[model samples]
Target: MRNVSIDELDDTPRVVVAIGTDYAHGHLLARHTHRRAQLLYGATGVMQVSTHDGSWVVPPQRAVWIPAGVAHEVLMLGVSTRSLYIEPEAVDLGRQCQVIDVSPLMRHLLMEAVEAPLNYDEAGRDAVLMDLLLHELARSTHLPLHIPLPVEPRLLGLCQAFVQQPNAHQSPRQWADQLHISLRTFNRLFRQQTGLSFSQWRQQACVVLALARLATGTPVTRIALDCGYESPAAFSTMFRRILGQAPSVWLAATNS
Candidate 1:
């Protein structure tokens, strides 16, 4: 027999339970851990999930899967969340956090799942609905919304500074000089530490930060300037290139 409960009390082959919650703008759920793997859907607004490994941004109509026992924190940018708690044995969603697009069907199913009883019946409609939910989550596309952070002390310092003031106009050479290192050393060590080239890492940082700001009703024109893009079109171009959707289109869709 299968089982479903927000709390794990057995080693069942199929277990999934859900809960619905809302958060006001700028709400932050401090670092925490859960016994069950979680699939959190941002039915409205946007969400930012961070772990020591990396950070992921979930825009509206998107969701994030966090593996069981991984420590994480979620920052809500005016989003309502429908969170599914699954027994680790029930799914192999990898050992990392992932942001994924929510299909229209999956979106509706999540809303329906949240209203389900604490322990859903295995032979009922809720079971079928839960099965479909798991299938959709496993098949969802993984988005490119992650920014992996470095662990080296000096590089970590530089990364922190860069994130604080993301200037697209700033070059790797300039950053290297700030750290008193040669451009060649900076290039090599940056990739070694962050698993991405300096330019690539900077772009990821910019996009992540830009998404958070955009979620709060900031205009593309102003955000571009703040993030140090030369022009709105340039910013949009990079946003589309990296995220596969224009800023205006994404912001509009999320708000609608």
Candidate 2:
């Protein structure tokens, strides 16, 4: 399935089937859609998935569930990926994209799935495997791994710029001044456009950026300073606040 189009998988009769492959760093798959919903999982790297509605970050050992017929593009960072295409009618997942943590059982199930024939036997071991896989997927935990993009063009530009060089110290007043809008107006428009306040958006962006950096074995201290935090302690504090644990503990659990 290395070079096969996802459309071809749509014709597969199985309720769920997988295509396992890997991508080099910085590889981009331009926007596309499939007839079946997809679980794009990366066992060893990060992926940034984007659609017209929003963008999501899938850190190592996790996956993103994309509903059928949504146009999305994926940028892979040296990932060992396993893609699952499922008949939406066969599953109860809602019609939205979500990031889910792949458990040990789910991980093994995915790897095993790619090894089975596309037209797998429905009354044999293959059926049981796929059934268990679907069960695990439906029960996986959702992560706060998404950063919604703004609909307003001017605000969109600002959001893109900030992502490129995020700094924790940049104040809302400074952003308002740069945009030549009053602080009150900026705050209101930002919330209206992105459904989040300036401060909230900044924190979300920082956490998303930090994930990729941390996955590459970068030190937490350096990641903090690079993201414009005053110190490692400050960065860890924020990281724990947003993610509910220190970076080391959080990442170890995910990777394990």
Candidate 3:
């Protein structure tokens, strides 16, 4: 139900419980875990979700699938959220957290879901809607919005620092030197730990960080320079290459 806490109804017999909540700008929900799987959709603004393993940025009109019992924290940027807490046995989105694309139909369904009763009838329109929503979620496309973190203390510190002040020009050799390891060893270890090459992860970090600012109406030129790009054109090229559209175009679509 609207503006309700899931904890109040966590034991409800329904297979799925929906809730809608709004957060002020720059609100943070500290680390917490849930007994049920969650499909957290941002109807507006951006969401930054972090777990022990990685971080995900969910832009407007997108959602993140958080598996049951996964401890995570969320930072909401002017966000209004529609969340689905599903019984673990009712669906298996996946074991890992994911940022998924929400179709227009799915978006409408999520808004409608938050209006359904906590104890919605099992053999009625609400049940049918919930079933359709689950089907839509299963077919949703996963996005490359996740930045996996390394477990090693030294490398993890470096990764965390870079995320705070991302720079496109940061070189792998620099990180290797800081870790006091040879470039060869760093490359191998970086891939093994994060499942991506150093260069690939660097680009991803820059793009994901840019998205948070972009959602707040930051200008492209400013964001480009902040991300260490030489020019807005250069930044847009990289943004398009990774996300398939220029930053402005993508933001427009997300807001539309």
User: Clashes in each model (backbone N, CA, C under 3 Å)?
Assistant: 0, 0, 0
lDDT of 3: 0.93
How many Å off is the CA of 29 in candidate 3? 0.7
Better of 2 and 3 by TM-score: 3
Q: Which pairs of residues have clashing backbones in candidate 3?
A: none
Two-way lDDT contest, 1 vs 2, winner: 2
Candidate 2: stretches off by over 4 Å? 1-3
Model 1 pairs in collision: none
User: Lowest lDDT 10-mer window, candidate 2?
Assistant: 1-10
For model 1, residues 1-256, the per-residue Cα lDDT tens digits are 1223344533444588677778888899899888889998887888989998878888887889999999999989888888888888877879989888888899899989878765678899999999998898888898878888888888788787877788888888987898899999989998998889988888888898888788877789998999888899999998898888999888887777
lDDT of 2 by residue, 1-256 (tens): 4545666667777788788887889999999988889999998888999987678889988999999889999999989898888888877677768889888899998888888887889999989998998889888898887787888787788788888898998888997898899999999988888788888888988998899888878999999999999899999998898889899998798667
The lDDT of model 1 is 0.84
lDDT ranking of the models? 3, 2, 1
Q: List model 3 lDDT by residue over 1-256, tens digit each.
A: 8888888889999989999999998999999999999999999999999999999999999999999999999999999999999999888878889999999999999999989888899999999999999999989999989999999999999999999988999999999999999999999999999999999999888898889889998999999999899999999999998899999899989888
What lDDT does the true structure give each of the candidates? Answer: 0.84, 0.86, 0.93
Q: Highest TM-score among the candidates is held by which one?
A: 3
Model 3: lowest-lDDT 10 consecutive positions = 1-10
- TM-scores for all candidates: the values are 0.91, 0.92, 0.98
